[model samples]
Target: MVTTLLTPVGDAPWSTEEFESRLRAVPEERYHDRHAFNIRMHSGALSQAELRCWIANRFHYQRHLPVKDALITAKLPTPALRRMWLRRIQDHDGLEEGEGGIERWLRLGEAAGLDRETLLRGDTVLPGVRLAVDGYVNFCRLRPPLEAVAASLTELSAPDLIRTRVAAFERHYPWIDPDGLAYFRSRVPQSRRDGAEALRLVLSWAYTRKDQERAVAALRFACDVLWSLLDAVAHEHCPEGS
Candidate 1:
């Protein structure tokens, strides 16, 4: 188990410490880092084609990150919060063209033998992958800002995941250009910084037991989105009955 909640839900409101404990438990238990495809990926078991499929399909999700962040950014009540969240959008979209996380991700695609135009064209994206990514975007667009931020808490596990990816790619997938790993390498510190701020916001905003539970549920939904997207990719390529 990831964590044993110090306090049970449906009781009185949890103390801030206890509520935070619950949120921290989420990624430990539910983050897609534990997905089977990821397990195989880290073990250097994926064929080049399998790995490239992932790079191409995952771009479908990456390209929309700014769009999702922008939706959440607009709902922030304070200029201070909005300003802080705007950095997230800028991190992906960049201050000017031909920069930022999105471009770096395209370079990763190129290293994986996928052309940038093909990644942008979205033709390689599986139907389930499309649905999962779109669902996440819509989740931010419609849910309360608190829940949306809660969903982003998957970043809590992202730093370590990114690190593992960089190491694994360098060790296992020598066919890919090492420079193409810039996306994962840069994300290590970026995810930690982003996840910490997002966690603080969740802890502060979810002041009541109900709100805290909603945040937990939202994080669970986030885990589901990522896991489902991987399922789509794995189903298409992994050995039958895997």
Candidate 2:
């Protein structure tokens, strides 16, 4: 089975640099690229119906992204930290409809022919999808600040995947309106901004060896949460061996 906890209470201890190496390892091994959904999405192999399911199911994820950030923001005691992190919620939620990442994802679903009712009601969402996302939120809410920030490190690999996804959609799924891919487009700048800040936060605050290990563990768990969700979606929605 894939490793879940980074270092439990008593495993080998990691130094700060070792922790960084482990941190890098988490995404390298467990990032969404390893996921079957990503492989199909990036290759444009999914049918339109599969694409619709992707949008509908992933809409749940988009809804929770900001909420997770808000949870983290609520935890920060300092105004400066809170102020810096609060932008994430705004970026995802946006000022109004037809804006923000969530809106863009909805457009993608519409372009894929998903009805608003089914999409909004989340009637088609897989149980594992909700579990993985909830796991992420709970981790942020319950973990130490360093670990929570480290968990956000999944954003590090997002830009590349976004680019690949857009390219695939443009090439293979021309029937899809270009506007629907906005979810990936909007994520580019926001992911970079949030990821850079999160990386710096984890590196700076995780001073001790044990703290660094915890931070790495946090990141690995976050990656698993995301990767596993995509896996669940793919298994449930995608056709045989897809």
Candidate 3:
């Protein structure tokens, strides 16, 4: 009979060292070094067409932010926690149309020469992109509250990425209009604040073997989701150097 290998569950409540170690490893192993969008952005190698494609495709990701936030908010049991999380949705969606993160991203898209309709259609999304984002929302919905919070640890690596991205935009996309880069610039501080809060919530709440295991699993899944999204973007957009 064929049998699957039984990997260590790591489910028991973890010490602070165990928790942090798991957290650190997720990004190191799974973050988006392989994503073409990031590779191009970091290397200052993206053409205007590549930049435009990145903006156009990223619209789907921005549009889904509030939907996932709503799913998370629905699961929170306390009014205080719900209220705290509500701000997260508002930050992405804003009080009106043509505002907030999505709008800012749209501005970036337009600057990259993509139209609003094409950006919004979602038809152009690469297959792996949907899988990664769907996995993220699913992980958030299925995991315990502490574990779900832990999954947001993608933010831990995000601030550094945001800085690099901002510099890359300035250096490489000089003709893309500085105002259009506001979305990337805006996210750096937001990522830091959100990452810190999510880390605090996870570290403070996950105090048992089962909880630690679940937290680590959630973080691993989150990293996979992020890495997969970039992989799809790279595969579909860059295509091994065309």
Question: Could you say which candidate leads in TM-score?
Answer: 1
Alpha-carbon local distance difference test for all models: 0.90, 0.80, 0.76
In order of appearance, the predictions have TM-scores of 0.93, 0.88, 0.87
> Which TM-score value belongs to model 1?
0.93
**Candidate 3 lDDT over residue span 1-242, tens digit each:** 99988647654456787778888788877777546668877888876666665666567767877877788788888998899888889889988877799889888877766677767787567777777777777777776678777877888888888898888888877877789889888899998898888887778887677777777788878777766666665666542111
Mark the 10 consecutive residues where model 2 has the least summed lDDT.
233-242
C-alpha root-mean-square deviation, candidate 3: 6.0
- Tens-place lDDT digits, model 2, residues 104-128: 7777887776777667788888899
Judged by whole-model lDDT over C-alpha atoms, candidate 2 comes out at 0.80
Candidates 1 and 3, the one with greater TM-score: 1
In lDDT terms, which candidate is top?
A: 1
- Cα lDDT of model 1 by residue, 1-242, tens digit: 59866665556788888888888898899888899999999999998788888888889999999999999999999999999999999999889998899999999988877877867888778999999999999999999999999999999999888888888889999988899999888888899999999999998898777898999999999999999989999899632111
| Ten residues in sequence with the least summed lDDT for candidate 1 | 233-242
True-structure lDDT of candidate 3: 0.76
Query: In model 1, how large is the Cα lDDT of residue 135?
Result: 98
TM-score result, candidate 2 = 0.88
